[model samples]
Target chain A: MPKHTIISVSDLNGALKDVVEDTFSDLWVEGEVSNFKAHTSGHLYFSLKDHQSQISCALWQFNRKYLFFTPRDGMKVLAHGALSLYPPRGTYSFVVKSMRPAGEGDLNLAFEALKQKLAAEGLFSTHKKQKLPRYPQRIGVITSETGAAIQDILRVIQYRFPMVHVLLIPVMVQGPGAAEEIARAIYQFNAQSDPIDVLLIGRGGGSIEDLWAFNEEVVARAIYHSTIPIISAVGHETDVTIADFVADVRAATPSNAAELATPDQREVLQIIANLRYTIKNRTLRKLEVEQERLRNLRGSYALNRPRMMLEEQLRRLIEIKRQLLRTTQLQVQQARTSLQLREGQLQQLDPNAPLKRGYVQVFRDQTLLLRANETHPQQLLTLRFLDGSVAVVVNEVSQDR
Target chain B: MSQRLSEHTFSEAIQSLEQIVRTLEQPVPLEEALSLYEEGLSLAHFCEARLQEAQLRIEKLSLQPSEVHPSTL
Candidate 1:
């Protein structure tokens, strides 16, 4: 490389940008705020200074919304962001993604770090969330008995779902041993011979320091490991704590936690009524189906009635009448045919039948003589013809021989 | 019919009643439907009795620091 080589200011700043951002990208800077100004575009421009040194800082609109408090000049704050450089101006600055007041700033950092660590361990996973009971008979509350949280929970539980027992395990909700006490209370409720349906562990609205017990790792771990579902209601709606993430449910207030724990009596009544309506309708439908089946069976079997039996018999009788008519007609036709045949046969047997044909047959008395030997000589005989009768006399009778 | 729910809690009774009603909404054999209706009616009765018998009992559980269970921490 040539020693005299030169580059544009943008190139020099660009080279410095990579070094600054990479070295100090993820770090927190503690200093007094100076020259704090918020742009109309929601970007925040400020300077962080100590007694000896100062640095320009910028908070983007995207990160400004995450700050719980506004930064003002002369406020001691901890600003966390990546160091960035503007190539055009050749100026380096800290882009503050989050800023908090100095005293609780460390706590906030620890809170965020623990939250991420626990999240990585699956403590905040939805799969590990316990199901809340729909109709909770026993609701366990762990808060200071003297606090308004207990009173609020009790009043709400009694007013909404009176058919419930509130087992209040009074525990210190703040200060040094408060987290340990709350954790013990949760475990005590879990180990009881009789189980509570849901546990509400919280205090009334408070400042972050006052609600610090809920952010303690012990409390969050207890909430995570408890077999019973827990509703975290440590502070006001905006003040979210680690217990809120660990618990099965998060309520904005103690009263809200009670509301979540139990069902309203009126709603329960409606559910029961709806179930009754369904059962009634279903049973009625079943009976109607059975009755329809019975009716159908009766219709098919109604031939057992005397009138139906008589109608069936009448139908059979008409069929018999038709058969009789047919049989009688055939018999009459046969009789007529047989009578004509007999008449023809009788005509052929007539003694005078041959007389009309110029052939004579003699009969003595009333006897029918079919042979000449049967006739007597000189005997008077009568011969019958088809139309008339005649008397004849045989002078001689002889055999053909 | 109370003996049928002797072992059930109030919530269990209500849950059973809900289940019975849901089951009855579908097609079931006649005998099974009759039995389910009977069971549901009894469960409903049990739940109603529980509602009437309910008393709001609030008990404060005060434990000393030493009384706290050791394994709980």
Candidate 2:
């Protein structure tokens, strides 16, 4: 094509703006951010630069709301949008729809990569998590010595369980070599002959860069390999680190880690006091039951009416004795009457009664006067009369009718 | 009763005390109940003493000459 003669400057600039906008539109450019400015109208103007090249970029508030993080000068970013040009200024610029920190994006990518690798290795599995000691006698803390994290942890532990022994293994929680230091602290705790019951490793809240040590693969591996139960309290409540996934327990803050380490002594005391009260009450109830049994026995008739029971037995014995005595007296009286009747009958049959009627009994050895025919002369006889005895001679024999 | 209460820790003492309390709740003979009550009282005393006398002791591990890693400082 032949070049046109006498073209206006405005026309040239307008043509260039259309060509630049149509060609470089909807492309991603990578560079370090410079002269970053945010106007009060919620619009951003910045320059994307490299070692040998530079371009201007603008972001509207509508698009800025989609950014995950705020952009700053000297930060490497990947800006996505169209190349825009202004006719009046005769300048070409990139209209940014979105921007990201290249370094942070890489860190985030690495974070995701490591998380997937560890998760596949079963480091974040629930079964791999060691059960935290319900009552930890000794607590091993791995954190910065002079940080507010240590102060917060110590305060919570002292308030909750004063009896716990806190062993602070001061370690660099951030910056270079922090991951190695944290990992070594864990190993050191495990190497001891008498390891602590639980380990609390954490630092206060900060940016992802500041808290990057916790997300390191070395720190995650160390936490996974810990023989003692580990509680990870790495950042604020909203922040989650890789260490949290590998630890046995994940606490939202440093103070929360201390709370999870040991049980509250005050709560324990209250439980013990309740137990004591229950025991005393149970014992008293036992005594009451026993007393009730004793009272029943005491009020029984056998114990209270000993005399009455004996009196009843005594009355029965007396009645039996009286009946025996009456029977014996009747037998004696009947025997006496029979003896007297027999005596009367015997007395009437006596031969002395005939003698009392004046009859006489004669003996015949010397002659008897009862018969005359049987007597011989010159015989003497003796006779028995009622009142006297007489002697007689029989001269004649006579028969009396 | 074989384990001396004084030798037990606060947790152990509390556990034994709770056991005694549970036994007492059952229908036991008077003599046995009396003995259990005595044991519970002793263990309760031990737990209270432990809770009252316990103090917080914080021990800082000495930094090695070559491995002095002060993070925030």
Candidate 3:
């Protein structure tokens, strides 16, 4: 029933695709980017729009590496690509092969200019930078709490050094108001009476413009004046910002910043263990030395000649005392026997015994004479027996052999 | 003297332990060495006790959008 030549939707789209692609291939289409989205495949999807109309654009990941700047919404850019068609939808889009920043600004130039100015002012001077604390107690982090920078930092820090206290002063890390917010955060931390040992100010990997806050003069100046040592970690490893130069130290990324901020607990524990071992060894050696000295002193006592001689002399004195005791015991036994014999003899000759046996003694003139020649005149005489006595005045004595 | 050592932190304990080891290396009198050995062992224990801790405390402060003070800038 169709009068004209009939074509399927796909056929017409394919025909149009070839025509449009051939004509518009490799042309410079100038427009403002809008509704931009980065797909997980490293491909960029966005709409380049003007006051009148908008066109969908796709910059594949391969082409994106050549881009001088990240194409954001409202950013003017000169995109080089060819038109393409999605046959199913019968729609056309620009497949951008290469792109560059255009109009109103160049981030690279601005970065260089600011860097020179700050360098001239000695903001990045090595002398001005403070040394980082070997062991940081509290680390003040100035970044977006919801960003990858915070997460990466926390994960790394928790792994390497979990004892550290992380104080996050959340701030805008992108677009408008990010620079001033970051600068104010630095000042706020500095104003505290108990300031943090170090400050980690940064964001995750981004385009230069996304990390533009770190390049701002205010942030650089704030870093320069901060009393607390600052570590600036902005964007990817290749992305260097002015804050990196002005900070006391610059890290390759957010995770690296956390690494630099802390001393590894493993190494610290090893050090402590080593010290314990060393002290134990040293103390044992000291005790051994003392023991050796005591042993030496004991050995020297055994070799002392005067002490040995005194010991020998004491042994002889003991022997001499034993001999003296034996001799004295024998002498006492003999003396007892001799005394017994003498006692028997003396008893036999006792005067009292003789009196009891009927013997008497006579006295004349108060004297007893054994000789007859001894005569007394008118002298008192006495005779004594066992129990009786008599008195007389006579003198007669007999001499007996 | 022993209270002070117990109260020392890991940093202080390690420093003092190092010093004690240095003193112990020399030939000290037995009475002095014995006391130093006691102190060194205690300091090492203090350092060990500190290693058992690994608590991560995170405090996040909120900031209003554009709450920056420009005058400081």
Best by TM-score: 1
CAPRI verdict (incorrect, acceptable, medium, high) for model 3: acceptable
DockQ for every prediction shown: 0.35, 0.33, 0.29
Ranking by TM-score: 1, 2, 3
Per residue, candidate 1 scores C-alpha lDDT tens digits across A280-330 of: 779889978978987887777464587778988999999999999999999
> Candidates' TM-scores?
0.62, 0.55, 0.54
lDDT of 1 at A239: 86
Point out where model 1 deviates above 4 Å: A1-102, A299-321, A337-401, B1-8, B22-32, B35-39, B66-73
Report the candidate with higher lDDT, 2 versus 3.
2
Error of 2 at A41 (Å): 56
Model 1: clashing residue pairs? A352-A384, A352-A385
Count clashes in each candidate, considering only residues at least 3 apart in sequence or on different chains: 2, 2, 1
- Cα lDDT computed for each candidate against the true fold: 0.81, 0.82, 0.80
Q: Runs in model 2 with CA error above 4 Å? A: A1-102, A293-401, B1-8, B26-29, B63-73
The superposed Cα distance between candidate 3 and the true structure at residue A15, in angstroms, equals 64
Per-residue lDDT of candidate 3, residues A87-157 (tens digit): 88889999987665545476675567678878888998999889997667679999998999999999998
Candidate 3, residue A3: how far the Cα is off, in Å:
73
Q: DockQ of candidate 3?
A: 0.29
In model 2, the Cα lDDT at residue A257 comes to 92
